[model samples]
Target: MESVFTILVLLTTVGLSGFVTRVIALKLPLPLIQILLGCVLAWPGFSLHVTFDPEFFMMLFIPPLLFADAWRIPKREFFRQRGAILALALGLALVTVPVIGYSVHALIPAIPLSVAFALAAVLAPTDAVALSGIAGKGAIPSNLRHILEGEALMNDASGLVALRFAIAAAMTGVFSLRHAFLSFVMIAVGGLAIGAAIGWLSIVLSSWFKKRASDEDPAAGVIMMLLLPFAAYLSAERAGCSGILAAVAAGMMMNYQSLRADMSIVTRLRIRGTWGMIEFVFNGMTFILLGLQLPHIIGSALIAAEAQGYTHMVVLIGYVLLVLMMLHLLRFGWMWGLRWLARRRRQRNATDLAVSGWRPLIIMTLGGVRGAVTLAGALSLPILLPDGMPFPGREMAIFIASGTILCSLLVAIVGLPMVLHGVSGKEDGLAAEERYARIEAAQAAIRALAETHDQIKVGLDESATVRVADCFARVMDLYRRHLEVLGADQTADEMARLDDQVDIKLRTRGLQAQRAELLRLRRRQKINDETLNKLLAEIDLAEAALFTRSRTV
Candidate 1:
């Protein structure tokens, strides 16, 4: 009960801090703010020792987060960049482990090669949420942004797999190249199979439920949507496969399946909003937990080291930074190798190939943002190895992981701003691309509504005919104005004003008519209160979407 209560309070507090970060607008990043605040809360006087269980944390956080990310990514873009994402996510990670592992072992002889590889694997998973978040604000190219996001999404499984094998090697004192390679292939393929089966079942089930669903009950569809990620993860784990990849694959399937589900627009919108908040809390709480543990780990390490005549805080931090630098160097070299490989194959459109010169490479290396995953993996290390002895360099390992994570984040949050100042072309290009995409999307809706309007026109009375025409006409006009604005040479502020004006006109004429008709139907007892409310809610959502689109591009 206490733990639950603590979590609730922390989430509430963390949420407020996030809000505060937005309100303040130009200070530190929210993750850093949360981490710093967490450090303060971790002060001895504060009795909040927020603990975590590795299995529980992975189960609770990883699936939903990865699922949401995978679901949201553009399916076409993801697959198109599949080779690049895989190379960086899996290939680079595989390389990073041995390279960083060797570096760590060489830098600090006290830490075993196996443990160093474990730490390296932990750090290899770049949770680029923060980088991607700010990248949307401008600076990073759209193609680059896709690469970052894709790599982040797929790399979790690779990192986890690496960590697993590294741990196994550590415990048994044996590292088998062929055996590990076979295991990787098995886990990945098996996870995909399981996830695909689950995904197909979900789609079929959701469709059947939709046939019987109503607004109030919705045939338990939303519940199933929430349950699917957990189902994928658990099932995959049981089958000794990559649960992370399973959840991701399931999410990717659900993304398209959702289009086929006969769900209300309002319901879908509600799901997005709910998941948004859930992710906020999950990521926030994890980062806060990380900060809360950091000081304690450092203190513990220092005390133990002092007694044993080992290195203290300053030396440990320097060593961690050194290893961090090596990770960047390794990434730099791998990136060049990728560039060379892409050139050899004439892969012009690949993200890494598109990246010219060493400047982007350096930026990308620095931009590889590591966060809660690194810290969590480090903290989750077993207290004792398979031999029932204390894990080697446990304290130092935690410190190094924490420090490296901080550096990665800081490099992105602090350094990227300075680097990106010299670069703004991507922002403008991204905006134009978005405007074009939005126009295309709206045009699609326009086509659908036109077909619907035409089909129903022949059977309807004059009043219904006019209403049907207006439905399609209003949407078509919205798209027209959107395309017009994109071609205009007006300032952003002027364009925004035009958007607002059009949004108001559309809401006042189209959505308002729908609401008025619904009220009239209710008054005449032609429609029940429930049906009227549902219709009204749908109108409200349409109005929301109209204004929302205006803001997005």
Candidate 2:
């Protein structure tokens, strides 16, 4: 808890410094700035020491972060680009370990190969949130963007699994390929099964509660929702499966299932906003914490390994940069080869090849900053061997991994913007136009519905129809505004603005109606609780759908 407070204060300072730097037009990556700040604070006397703990860090951070990221990745895109994602997430990670291990062994001959392998594994996984700045810049095409995001999400799981195997082999003094392979399969599949079960049960529980409850308490429902990820993850791990994979699977499943549930537009908006803020804070703190850990690790290593002195440190830093560059080069080379083959196949089939945008691939590779998970894994390394001696090269290995993270962040921030500039000209204006066209189509549908309602009201008796006519008139006004905004070039923005206004109006009107109806029911003393609850649920569902549709578009 003290550490958490320290982290919050340090992060707040880091954020302010980053803002100051940006305001003055400095061009460093935010992560880099945070790392430097961490270093400065850790210098003796500043006293911002964070004692890294394995279990606490993993439990507090990884699951929710992974789940949130997986939930938002477009399921359709993930499937479509599954092959590329697999190659990078799984294949590239396998390639990275041995390559990085050998390179580090050559650079630091004193370090054991197992320790080097562990370090390599730590640095292999990419942090998806670290790329938010690049992605938010809107420099990549939709296809490439989705593919990059999918790759990041999948590789997080893949990398963690690989790291675990490497760690287990290091600790047990045995590395069985057969066991490792079987373990990976079991963890992944078992986690998936666990996640599915949790998702199913959650839905059942929520439905049961919704059916029997009389107060219509959505807060209770939201509480149940928060428990699913943690429950699925912890339960799977307790059952000898990957908690990381379980959390991801559960989140993905929940995101899919929740689409059909009854929710008010207000609730959805509130939830989205809440999750977005959570993710942002988590990401910012994760990077800052990673940065904060570096100076201490590196300084400690320098003191412990006195044989080679600062020269060794300098050489190791160079090696870390080499390994970092190699990571990017391999990913880029793999993507290039894959795209070339894809293009050849498309030509053979007389079909247009999907554009393999370079900027996104660049962003993806460079954005691979080893963060909280890597640090957590590194700290999890056994402190002592079976012979009662300290784990060989553990401190030095952590230093190298931390240094690699810094190098990766620097490269990404500096290189991504240039790549984006080179490729921004190729954006598909035609696609944007098509999206605008769809907005018009939806607006037209709404307007047509309003018009039909107006015509139907015209044929009714004036006394009986006046109230219904008034409703249609209000609805017609809404549709007219929507239609007017549809064909505009800023259609997405315009629709979003209109949708917000509608949500506000719906909330105000729905609450007023509910209050009035409740009074009427109380006066008559004849309202069935079940019927009244069902009506409320229906209103909530309609309100939810309005926001969902608007946002989805």
Candidate 3:
């Protein structure tokens, strides 16, 4: 009962934070607001005690969130930017682990080198979710955002795997670099292959069910879809592989499967809306949980520091600041070196690079914000070694990880807006692509209508054929006008624009009338609730379509 109550409270808090963020005039990011609310909830008067379980948290929240991100990211852009993503995700992890490990050890000799490396490993993965919340929608250039998103998706596994090895080294007091490398390669490859196979198998089974089942309802399919990430994660972990990468691979496979599958519109929309809500709730809960843990972690660390002959909280804070500074410095230098090499290669007529400018480099550096994963990894550290001795620097590591997450969020919240101000995001040819798609679809519709009309006219009486032809002509003219609008001269363009305006107005007004009549019928008992609801839904969808088209035009 207590566990259930705690969950209810957390859910309510998550929902209320969304409301508060909107109601407040400060315009703070949602994650920041949720974290603050969490801190408030952690007060003694609240009596809100919840245990933190790292493995469960990762399994519960991380897989679906990562899957959603992978599913949504443009596959072409992800592949196109693979080189940069791998460099940051894998190569940078390799670099950051050692550099940060040595730095942490040098600063606090009390921490063993292995433990320091563990801390560094956990901090390696960036939180693109937090970055997006801080940066706001469409704030970063699209290309840079893709790269950042890809890096975040891939680095989680790398970081966690490194942490696992670090923990092993700390426990056994022995380490093998070559063996770790081989294990990482096997784990990563095996996870990817397993995830892809599972995803493909799910698609095949779904298709089989669609053929065998009589009902068209999408509930069963939606439920299966929701379970996919968890299944992938658990399966890979059981196989001694990287579950994070498995979830990511499964998500990527989902994108490909969706493109090829002939799914109902209802199923697509339902899946989209469901996942949107899941992403929101999970992300909010993750941050709030972080906030809930902060006071205890920091207070305990401060007390431990005092016992160790350090008297001030500032000393611990200084360590966080110093570590954060080193991270940014390393990120900036790495990116700058990549840019220089690309520039030199471009001079040799090799190829053009996607990311350019020092400002973007700075934005990317600041965008590398840490979040829940780092804290979870830190907290997951074992409390006792094989010799029955307490784990060295566990409290300090957790405190530093928590502090780093907070500080990184604060820094990006303050720094990103300043850097992004007055900077224009580069156009990624979306408008041109949209225009081309519209023209092609319109042409196809015209062709299909013409063919259908010919078939129908051949079997009808002259009068019926005339009526049928008239109906088809009216629908076909709409498509023709759309095509004309797409490829119009200056004068024709003005006329087409006016026609679109008048058409949109008529359609919107008609939809509004339909909705009004629907409600009126229900009020007068002229229609059953089910009938009214079904009709109203159609009307609402029409209105939404009109609104979307108006905005697009």
Minimal lDDT window, size 10, model 2: 347-356
Q: In model 2, which runs have C-alpha deviations exceeding 4 angstroms?
A: 1-37, 40-43, 134-137, 304-307, 344-361, 422-471, 488-553
Give candidate 1's whole-model lDDT: 0.79
Measured by TM-score, the strongest candidate is: 3
Write model 3 residue lDDT over 499-527, tens digit each, in one string: 88789899899889888988998999999
- Ranking of all candidate structures by their lDDT, best first: 3, 1, 2
Task: Tell me, by lDDT, which candidate is best.
Answer: 3
Candidate 1 lDDT over residue span 395-414, tens digit each: 78888888888887777777
Better of 1 and 3 by TM-score: 3
Which 10-residue span in candidate 3 carries the lowest summed lDDT? 347-356
Error at 223, model 1, angstroms: 1.8
User: What TM-score does each of the candidates earn?
Assistant: 0.86, 0.80, 0.95
Over the stretch 1-553, how does candidate 2's per-residue lDDT look in tens digits?
Answer: 8778786786686567557557756655555556566667667786688777777777767887877877887786677677777777788777788888788787788788888888878777777666655334456555556666666766666667777777777777789889888988898789888987887788777777767878745676766676777898899889988787788887888776558657555456556777777766666666667766777787676775567676866776777778777777877777666668768777422211135456555655565656567677777777898779998888777777777766776676777677666555234764677668866776777768777776777768877588787876777665555555444558665775667577667775786687578758956877777777777666666666666545533
What's the alpha carbon RMSD for model 1? 4.7
Roughly what TM-score does model 1 have, to 2 decimal places? Answer: 0.86
